[model samples]
Target chain A: MIEVAGLTKRFGPTLAVSDVSFEVQKGEVLGFLGPNGAGKTTTMRVITGYLSPSEGRVRVAGYDVVEEPLEAKRRTGYLPEAPPVYPDMTVVEYLAFVARIKGVPRREIQTRIEEVSEKCAVTDVTDRQIGKLSKGYRQRVGLAQALIHNPEVLILDEPTAGLDPKQIIETRELIRGLAGQHTIVLSTHILPEVSKTCERVLVINQGKIVASGTPQELTHRLQGYETVLLTAEGPAAEMMERLQRVSGVNLVEPRDAADSRVTFEVHAEKGHDVRAELARAIVESRWKLLELKTSGLSLEDIFLQLTTKDLGEGPDTSDKSSVVGIV
Target chain B: MRNVIAVAGKELRAYFHSPIAYLVMTVYAALLGFFFYSFTATYVVQSFRIQAMGGGMGAPPMSLNEYIIRPLLAGVLTVVILLLVPLITMRLYAEEKRSGTIELLLTSPLTDLEVILGKFLGAMALYAVLVAMTFLYVGYLFLHGNPNAKPLLAQVLGLLLYGAALLALGMWFSTFTKNQIVAGVVAFAVFLLLFVMDWVTAYGSGRASDVISYLSLTKHFDNFAKGVIDLSDVVFYVSVVVLGIFLTARSVDALKGRA
Candidate 1:
């Protein structure tokens, strides 16, 4: 439902977004994963028709944002980083105003207001002035404003930035519930949010799309080798020698030894499951097996690997074995 | 049109919901009321003095339109509006930009003209209310005196147009900055300069003098206060109003590129 091609945005001489391209299919929830100042917000703004791209084009629902802004804007709902709300107006008043501007029929404005207020869980504060509401309520109100028009595409820039933990969970649930009905593009620096909510993740760094794939794919692709953490009551050097003898074992590094238990980080060859062999070797050796678990690279590790790579290197450097070797 | 009204309605509510509207109205009413009292007192005193002279030397009875309503509308109210209009308009775009609400407005399906016109009309509505309060004071004159209604209506029309022009200019200034205080101060300074622009004409003559005198915002009101609705003055104020709106629309458009 949204396509951004060669989208480059510059503020004066500094490029905010550079030659970035991506698409979110209809009803697909796409997550923009990046650290702060990663051009995620800038790209979202260009897509929402708030800021024009300095170089390329953005289309939403088949309408060009620069050429047919009204049509594109009509089908897109945007919640900016700051939750564009007037503090003096009540929730209902603010929603009604949004409904009107978004072109909800005059007769349907009241119902639409109630509908979004219910969906965003802001019904309780409908009559209270927005300025008096808590930050969570205000953020929800911003979401309600974006949903008031029932637009086909929703562009949210850091939809869960400042919420308490409980509120964050509730917001994630709300966004997940919205998945099949609305095409969503939400940006966040929080890694877990992408794994939890998005069907596809676009990892952006330094004004570029550094990586893109499903959450599991990102982890698996970046992790070329398998790592297992094992703790056992054994002689550390002897156990390391014994594990190194097992087939497919690349290296065995001792982590720590305390209370007669030695922990080892075992690295295996790619696509190798050394757990069974290591377990059998430990069981037959007369050493008590205290702990054995496969410690795969989590999304946090993958995100750090993708974003922290040297800026001068190409994005393909992320998939190189040298980088994944550390993970 | 509906989009315009939506934005306009929001702007109007923003004013009423905040203390700014009430504060401006109260202060404006107090100042105009004080001026009305002083003008009435001076009119009464002048009329008595003329009566004591037994209408000697062909000193006709002081006309209420000349001695009271004219100066009150053309002079005192003009200065008062100069002070209060900046307050009404300073937040039109500045506050929106500051609070990030401009994102909502610009990203909506509404055109830049719709948003700009809506804001212009919203400020004009509040200013109209401020001008409307003068009617209560003006209405009292009809009860005890025979002031010409024609001149009163002309002065009111002139005052509204004058305010519309300044409000538009103030709104343009508002679009330049996110700080409301900065917008208000800069707008006030420009309005004051426009009010005194004709002062330079006293030192020069010919076409340059005429042009400066014509550009003086206060100079155009003289004909309206005298019950003459000169088309040139009407066109001048209308042109300024259009110019302000046009410049503001361009500024808002430029925001899309810069922001």
Candidate 2:
């Protein structure tokens, strides 16, 4: 439903998005995962025909955004980072105005407004001034306006940014319900939101695509450098020495020692399991193994690892393994 | 177009919903009313003096339409509009930018011309309301004295065109900045400069003076106040309106290159 090919945007000297290419199939929900200033909004703006790409082309519903902006815009609905709403107008007035400008059938505008207001759960605030509503309600009104015309594609930038926990869950469910009918590209910095909502994720960093896959695939790919925590009854120095001798153990350091019970954090080599080896070694050495904990890299770890690293080293390369670090 | 009408309707509703519209209307009506009463009193006093000198038998009476009403409607009304029209036009685009609503407007399917024309029509409609209130005073004149409808129509037409040209110019300046105060101030400065071009003509007598005098909005409006609907004057105001509209369109188009 949407195709962005080699898209690049430059604001004076800063390259907001650089030679980025991506595609969304019909009825697929693609999560744009990136930190702030990662060019996600810029790419979305280009796809929606709000901003022309400085270099390449963007097509929505088979219409080139630059050449046929009106046709492309007609099929796409965009909610910018900030909800573009007028405070003085009531929710119904704002929605009606949007419906008119978006070319909804004159006779069907009222019904369309009712349907979207219901879907977004903003019906009660339809008569209330938008300026007086809470932030959550205003956001729902923003969503209502976007869906008023029933566009085929929805481009939402950080849709659940400022909502409370309950509103966030409600909005997430609302977006999830919208899948399979409207192709969606939603950008977010919230990690769990993507894991629950999106079918596929594209991790972007420093104006480049660092990784792209299912949430499970991303976690599994970065699971090679999982860390382990061990508690043993022995001298701290002796435990560190013995744990370092285990095969696949890259680094070991004592965390703390109390009553001769020492805690150690063990860093293992990629794709290596040193837990069993260390446990057996401690038992043979007369040291009691009190507690052993091993954990795979979480999505938060993967996100921080992907974005905090500098570009031009290995993250920007197409090789997936090169992007992995001390996750 | 339907899109244009939709935008225009929204903008017009916005004007009435805010306090600025009523404020401008009240202030405008009060000023015009004071000027109308003073001009009529001065005309009535002058007529009495002329009659007392001639013994009041067959002395010719002064024409109120040419002497008082025309200047009040054409000259004073135009200046008042030039000062107040910014309140109507300043928020046309500037408020949208400040409030981040321009994103919604530009991303919609409507074209730039539709948005510009719709806003222009909205501002003109509000100005019409302000101008219509003065008709109450005009009606009072018709009840008491006989006046020529031809010059009256000419004055009304001239003021409409003059006000439109000013509104268009104000819209153009509003397109340049997101700050409404800056837009209003700059619009005022530009209109004042254009209004004073006739004085520049007095300082020189060459081709420069001719161009300055031609560019003076007051010079063209003077012809209309004198009961002459010259084609040249009509063309000048129309050209100004067209120029303002295109400049506004260009300002909006520049956003694409910078976006």
Candidate 3:
């Protein structure tokens, strides 16, 4: 329920977001991945009507943010990178103040506050001063304030930053549960956050979106260049020769071994799955299979591959391939 | 309007929660009490003695303010009124920016006016409390001697007008910086300059001195304290309030990037 077109933001001479465009459909949890300073927060600000885009338009729930600010704001909830908080106000008071400012119906404000607090699980500390809250609780309070009005579109900037591992996991689950009721656009540098929490991923580099697709599609596209390792109780020389004989096996080489068990690493031809063929050959050779390892690329690998500048350019782009070289 | 009141209520509550309000109250009561006892009370006792000696007292010292109090105390109320006003007003938009809570407030459906008026009215309510306590001196002034009701009315009105001007100036200063210290210092500086303008103009050998004195807040506010309903003085305070509120709204818009 959100649309952004030709969106650009310039802070003086610096272009923070450049010609960015994307849509998050109703009920879709879109993960926005970018390195630090990649313009994600700028984009989120533009969409939320907090910062008017230097050019183009952003519409949320059918209302253009610039042309109809209040209506657009009425339909959207946004949590900026810093959990906007007043240290002197307690959590309940803070939520109530936010509810009133956000134009929630006066009569329903208390109920709305309770609803969001329960949903974000910030109810227990509703009476505590926000400044006294731990980082995680403060964050949950921020989420509660954003969701108090139950806006249709939610734009969260790094919703799970600076938390212990368990808290991070819990926050992700909470965001995931918010899907379907609220169209979400969440930005983070965490790769697995995208894989676990987003149905579709949008990879941003510098100030531009470099790629967008399902997680499986990204991995499948990069699967063209992959390899497998197979160790078996067979002659290294003959096993390597036979594996090379199999169609779609591109390269074969011996790996260090123990006793009669020898190892060989094999590269597959483009679009090839050589597992069945390799297994068949080992059974025929009467070679006892000791170990078979397939190169299963993690989301980190996919992120590195797409974010790696050289691979994106077919090696003609600037060398950010060191990103890929690591891990 | 709901947003404004909501904000105003919170700000009023904030004043009580912080010790600064109590501190301002203590200082305000002490200074006003000094003026009440030394000037208003002595004037009333003398007027009564003069009337006892068969002389006609001016207007029979009707309200507690007549013999002992004048609207000028109300005008100078702007001085101490200003002391507390800037500390809170400086934090209006400045604290929000410093704490990054401006994003939360502005990003909501609240309009700029709501934010501005809410904060203004909130500060006004606290100033109202300070003004309320100062009235106790008026009560005491009326108890012993005849006091004029009319001048007392003018003084109360003058207190409000002075408050409106200073509050506006203070709120406007708040918009200039994110640092509360800077905001408070700058606001205090602006008032200090205005407070000293008449003196500087008196010393210098140019019509510029006359011009500075004319622009000085003290000059515009002087008529109010003297029980004179000068429209120009009213206009001047109104202008100050408008200017302060206008600049504050613009600042919030600029920071919100809607400007």
TM-score of 1: 0.93
Query: Cα-based RMSD of the predictions, in order?
Result: 3.1, 2.6, 5.1
Q: Which stretches of candidate 1 lie over 4 Å from their true place?
A: A232-247, A251-262, A276-290, A311-327, B56-59
Which segments of model 2 are wrong by more than 4 Å?
A253-262, A311-321, A324-327
By TM-score, the candidates rank as 2, 1, 3
Interface RMSD of 2: 1.3
Predicted candidate 2 versus true structure: per-residue lDDT over A188-235, tens digit per residue: 999999999999998887778878888998888865565799999987
Q: Interface RMSD for each candidate model?
A: 1.3, 1.3, 2.2
Better of 1 and 3 by lDDT: 1
Which docking class does model 2 fall in?
Answer: medium
Q: Write the per-residue lDDT of candidate 3 for residues B128-182, one digit (tens) a residue.
A: 8887886687776567555676767766777777787888889888887889889
Candidates, DockQ: 0.74, 0.77, 0.46
**For candidate 1 chain A, which ten residues in a row score worst on lDDT?**
A318-327
Query: Model 3 chain A, poorest ten-residue lDDT window?
Result: A318-327
Candidate 3, TM-score of its B chain: 0.85
Residue pairs that clash (backbone atoms under 3 angstroms), model 2? none
User: Candidate 1, chain A: TM-score?
Assistant: 0.90
Candidate 1 lDDT tens digits, B152-184: 889999999999999999999999999999999
TM-score of predicted structure 3, chain A: 0.83
